[model samples]
Target: MHYCQSCETPVAMEPRNGHAVCPECGRADDVAAPGPLFVVTGASGSGKTAVLAGLARRLQGRCVTFDADLLMDAAGALSGSRPIDWPAFRDAWLAVAHGVAQSGMPTVLLGPFIPTHLQELPARRWIGDIHFIVLDCPDELRRARINARPPWRSRDIEEQVEFGQWLRRNIADRVDTSSELQKTPRRPSPHGSTAI
Candidate 1:
């Protein structure tokens, strides 16, 4: 599930001369075997970055752990007031995760993503089951966490609070991040299936 950066269109798995070329922009890249995609999502300051750091340490040799935001620079320009194509950004990440999974290691991606963002994308077929784990904490605590971040990382407090509330209400698989992240239980097996 690749997205053509030039055309801003979803790229499907079709080969031309044994190479996967974007029908929309003629962009080319290699396609790899598919594997499950696990998304660790939450609002800003929900400890996603922290949790990813810990999870990466634990799952280092077992699976691939990545911060989805690392691709922000490649996804699109963020200097102006132009509206970002969030879905396209998400699809691009999915494609990357799929590529990484070809090594037989499932990818655990951390970002402000929800199941709705990736479940229905054409790239969804590139992976096996998609699992979503929402990280949440109380609104007041979340505000404090966000407030403590560096000025460059600051976000709209109200918006993040609302987004956190919405995730708790909609997602069943959640990790209460108000407490120490180390206290969080062991994650699902990273081999192929995620119990959560």
Candidate 2:
């Protein structure tokens, strides 16, 4: 198992190319708000979805959240047979998230966030504070979650094996997702005033 430089998650070394994509969270790592981005990246069973769901509830109005899949349709449009003007979609959404971040709001982006393909976000001009988060869990537990997924929903075991290894190697700051899945890693929220 090796860790991905971009996502920082342990994954298996085989079949590692066709899918550099993370099953837990996607390109939210590209967010560059200078402030905490309230990220949630991890392996499928790492409790990424569960943690984010809780985080969203915990931070209700203080955060503006978006799932990585929120732009999947638009991303797909970029390769449409007719090329459905996806550049416009990309620019639009990027601008929206950046705008929201700029509004002094603590924002959370949770989903299958991959960091490699997507460039770092919000252009140099949009700089602010930035922090990162990655959730973690034991391999057996991860496999169980994958298995619990509906017949059509879960990723193949082989694929998850590779990804699981990858995530283990990459993550440094992690919150283990056991039954308690302790909120042991409560991050300093990006909202509120900064000391001058």
Candidate 3:
């Protein structure tokens, strides 16, 4: 939250054009042009986390990359005692991405986000168009990878495989991570003004 200098009102800062202005006072804060959001989505064990690690390094100063899992701990806060409100959780990540865009860096979020998880959100207005890239691998490989993980992760292989197929059918961009496992993360599919 930003404070309006003249009126001392708390401002929920969101970029307009290329700047964020205090609605109370109309005093503008210089914010960089908003950048499009890039979402690298996949089912569990589809190499999203591994890919994010590489992207954070490779994208260094060019753009910012993040794992949506970083906010998992705060899910309780967002949802209270009820089951996690997934849409609210997604909104938080979108807000973070929009804030980063104000600093002139495009953001790539790594997670299990489908288009519906983002496209209709209120926060979507603060960022540019969203582009989704699904990371994919053979079903056998995906199962083996999830099973190899520590016991805490869900090992429901069939469910994940089904989800992966849905993503492939609905999203046009896909990175066959099994083929690229030895390589660094594949570059994300391009979108409206983002350099990634």
Best by lDDT: 3
Of the two candidates 2 and 3, the one with more favorable TM-score, higher being better, is: 3
In terms of TM-score, how similar is model 1 to the real structure?
A: 0.73
- Candidate 2 at residue 186, lDDT? 32
Instruction: Residues 55-169, candidate 3: write the lDDT tens digits.
Output: 8999999889988877776776666789877888888888898789878889999889988878888777777889999999888888877776665555678888899889888
TM-score of 3: 0.79
lDDT of 1 by residue, 41-149 (tens): 8997688766776799999898899887676665445524565577777777777777777677898988888787888776666777788889999999888776765
Give the winner by TM-score: 1 or 2.
Answer: 1
The collision pairs in model 1 are none
TM-score of each: 0.73, 0.58, 0.79
Q: Is candidate 2 or candidate 3 better by lDDT?
A: 3
User: Which structure among the candidates has the greatest TM-score?
Assistant: 3
The ten-residue window of minimal lDDT in model 3 covers 187-196
Indicate the residue-level lDDT of 86 in model 3: 81
